[model samples]
Target chain A: MLLQILNIVGIVAFAASGALVGVRKQLDVFGICVVGATTGIGGGILRDLLLGVHPPDSLSKWPNITASVATSLVVFFAHPVLDRIWSAVVLFDALGMGLFAAGGATVALQHGSGALGGVLIGATAAIGGGVIRDMLVNEVPLLLQRDLYALPALLGALLVVVCESIDLPQGISLIAGTAAATGLRCLALWQRWQLPRARVKD
Target chain B: MLLQILNIVGIVAFAASGALVGVRKQLDVFGICVVGATTGIGGGILRDLLLGVHPPDSLSKWPNITASVATSLVVFFAHPVLDRIWSAVVLFDALGMGLFAAGGATVALQHGSGALGGVLIGATAAIGGGVIRDMLVNEVPLLLQRDLYALPALLGALLVVVCESIDLPQGISLIAGTAAATGLRCLALWQRWQLPRARVKD
Candidate 1:
């Protein structure tokens, strides 16, 4: 039940982000919906594909589709209201990222992926939707260029793996993992932390 | 046997195209290889996921990876030589598109997809890789903006559906479908055929 609630929250947050980008890009209604749906479920789809799970959970479960579509419509119609609360949106996005990273790691581990594989898959799940959304808008993915984004997800996934390895209870491990990711992301934002970039000669 | 050979040919062509793009983008060796592999197999991966086929064929088969990596390396080192034969590359790309479209439609039908579903999946398989490659390099997919690119693949997929509906022999249907796509693509190139676009007001 908790997992389901978290998943819905993440889907709504991600879908809103995608819709915002679509509106900014002046995409058609169809394009906006496409981007929103992709952002909401693209990561889960990627994780499932990597784990060789066919007919991904997102497609099989009707609720996910509903949540994403509903969020898209809301964003399309209420951009004026939603756009003003940019900080709130960012907070929700960070929370969603943390939840997704933990969820993805758990799924990967359940499917027999190793610790490293779990971490990679988790990070991919956390960031894959954003990457796809950015690509649709013809922008570089923030995951690739932004500092401290992928790292938090990776660390969160690693925490799950370590906790599981030590036979910790599932619920507790999940909460801890999610908290670690969310906290780290918030800290990075507050500190304006950035990853180093290579210096190229002009 | 024939399908395997066709798949390899398509992989090589797509990989080369991806590598060429990476080189043009001035990406490093790792980025070049990443783009080449994504372009070579991303379509098949998408098709398989949609069809509920897990652990896509490309990941299971070593040859696909080898072909993409080898092509990436060759393009990185011998770009000047490859660049001089642009016509040859274009021809091979057209052939690959035809084969992949036909193959994707066949797979979808075999997996119990309806005619419309087959057509959609087929075109996706033919064009998904290039879309992904372009996105990785932060460019809008030509599939969306370019007129003739996706049309040929869609028509080829439709042909496959039509042929199977009439109970045409499998071999004949595949051949005819592939030929239709390849011929149309080549003609489009020769005649500079284009689809109409919406004119924006200045």
Candidate 2:
């Protein structure tokens, strides 16, 4: 039940962020909806594809579509107000990343992916949607350049793999993984932490 | 046997186009390879996922990866020469678009998709890889703004769906579908056929 709620929250957050980008890009209604829907579910779909799960659970289940569409509509109408609460939006995004990273790792492990594959899939699931959303707006994906974006998800996924390998209970492992990711993301935001760039003289 | 050869040609053409774009974008070798590989196989992967075929054949089979990587390397080293043959690249790209469109429609039908679904999936299979490649390079997807790009793919897919619905022979249907798409694409290139744009005063 908790997991389901987390998933819903993640979908909503991702959809809202996508819709926000769509609005900023001055996209039409159809374009906004497309961006929102893809951002909400694209990562999970990609993860499932990589893990050999067909037709992705996001498409098979109605709730995810509902949540994404509803969030898109809400953001479309209330973007002016939503834009003011940028910090809150970032918090929600971080939460979503944490939940998705943990969820992805768990799913990959269940599908018999090795630990390395699980971590890669988990990070992909956490960040892929945003990457797609950015690309749709003709922007460089934040995952490639943003400080501390992919790292938290990778660490969180690694934690999950380690916990599972040690036979830790699923619930505890999930909690630990989520906390690790969310906390790190929040800290990075607050501290203005950034990853070092290559010192190549371009 | 013919279809297999067509698929290989499509893969090589897509990979070469992606590598060309990577070079133009001044990306590193790794980035070039990544873009090339994705452009070659991303569409098929997407199509299979939608059709509920897990572990897409592109990943399971070695030939696809080998072909893409080899093309990427060739393009990376010989870009100066390749750039001079822009017309040939365009011709190859058109051929790939037509073949993949027909192939995607056939696969979707075999997987029991309705006609509309088959057309949608087919167009996706033909164009999704290029979209991903363009996005990775931070460019607007050519499918969205380019003249007469997607229409041919849609038409080819529709032709395949219609042929199957009318109980046409598989060989005849495939040839007709491919011809419809390829011929139209070639004509568009030769005659500068373009879709009408919205008359918005920008």
Candidate 3:
């Protein structure tokens, strides 16, 4: 039940991020919806394909598709108003990342994926959508660019794996992972944190 | 041996198409190469993933990737000359769609995929790269918009299925399917064929 709620929340949040990008790029309504739906569900779809699962849950489940489509429609209509609360959108996105990362790891674990596979799946499930979204929008992916995006998701996945190894309660582990990821992302943003790099001539 | 040669030709052709789009979009050299590579190989990647094949052939085989990357770079350096011959790109792309659509259908049939599944895979293998390229460029997918793109591939797939049912020689059938698809696309272009649509009232 808890996982389901988190899933819906995560899908909606990711959809918003996608919609925001589409709007920034001046896409028409249909294009905005395509981007939103793709970002919202792309991760799970990729994960499932990798796991040799066909017609992934996102495709089979009416709710997930409906949620993404609904979120897309909402963003289409309310983007102007929502632009006023940009910070809130960022917050929700962070939360969604946390939830989905944990959920992906949990799903992989339940399917008997090994510890390493679980962690990788979790990370992919969290960051894949955003990478694809950025790629589609012809921008350097945010995760690869700044603010410790993938780092938090990787850490969160690891935490979940550790909690599972120790037989910790699922709900508690999920909450802990989510909090850690979201907090880390927020901290990175607040501090303007970025990956270390040396200057290279182009 | 002939099929392999055709495959390489098709790869180079698609790579050129990708490079053309990238140049028009004003992407940097690196971005252009990425788009070219993606446009050249993204569809097959999707097909492999759906088939539960790991380390997709395009990624695993150095020759294939090398061919695509080298072609992309060549296109980058010779953009002006290439642009002058750009009409050939569309013709080559049409031929590539034919070759890949038949190739995909053959593989799916070998794997015992149903008729519909084989047709879907065949069409996807043909246009999937274009779709990915369009998505990355933030444009409406050409497959969903202009040209009778999907229809040609579908017809090719059906032709392959019918040939197999009638015990036609595999080599002959494959060639026939490819020719049919390519010819159909060229005819469609010549005739300005389009899917029916209702006028939008807005």
User: What does fnat come to for each candidate?
Assistant: 0.21, 0.22, 0.08
Clashing pairs in 2: none
lDDT of 1 at B166: 97
User: For residues B1-202, what per-residue lDDT tens digits would candidate 3 score against the true structure?
Assistant: 6555656666777777887788888899999899888888887777666655678888998766777788889888987865454465567678778877777677667766656556656766777787788888887665544557767887887788788778888787688888888899999888987543322211
Query: Per-prediction TM-score, please?
Result: 0.62, 0.63, 0.63
**Per-residue lDDT value at B121 in model 2:** 76
Task: State which candidate, 1 or 3, has the greater TM-score.
Answer: 3
Can you give the lDDT of residue B47 in candidate 1?
Answer: 86
Error of 3 at B64 (Å): 11
RMSD to native for every prediction? Answer: 7.0, 6.8, 7.0
Give the TM-score comparing model 3 with the true structure, all chains together: 0.63
- Compared with the true structure, all predictions reach lDDT values of 0.78, 0.79, 0.75
Q: Give the local distance difference test score of model 2.
A: 0.79
Task: List residue ranges in candidate 2 displaced over 4 A.
Answer: A1-5, A59-61, A85-89, A166-168, A196-198, B1-45, B49-106, B112-123, B136-138, B143-202
lDDT of 2 by residue, B57-152 (tens): 899999888898899899888888754555655676677788888888888888876776687678778888888887777777756444567778
Query: Per-residue alpha-carbon lDDT of model 3 for A1-202, expressed as tens digits?
Result: 8877877888888888887776666665656766787788877777786577753677546778678878877877776665344465467568778877888887788888889988999889988888877777677887766768888998887788889989999997788887788789989999997777899999
**Who is ahead in DockQ, 1 or 2?**
2
Pick out the ten consecutive residues of candidate 1 chain B with the lowest summed lDDT. B193-202
List TM-scores of chain B, every candidate. 0.90, 0.91, 0.90
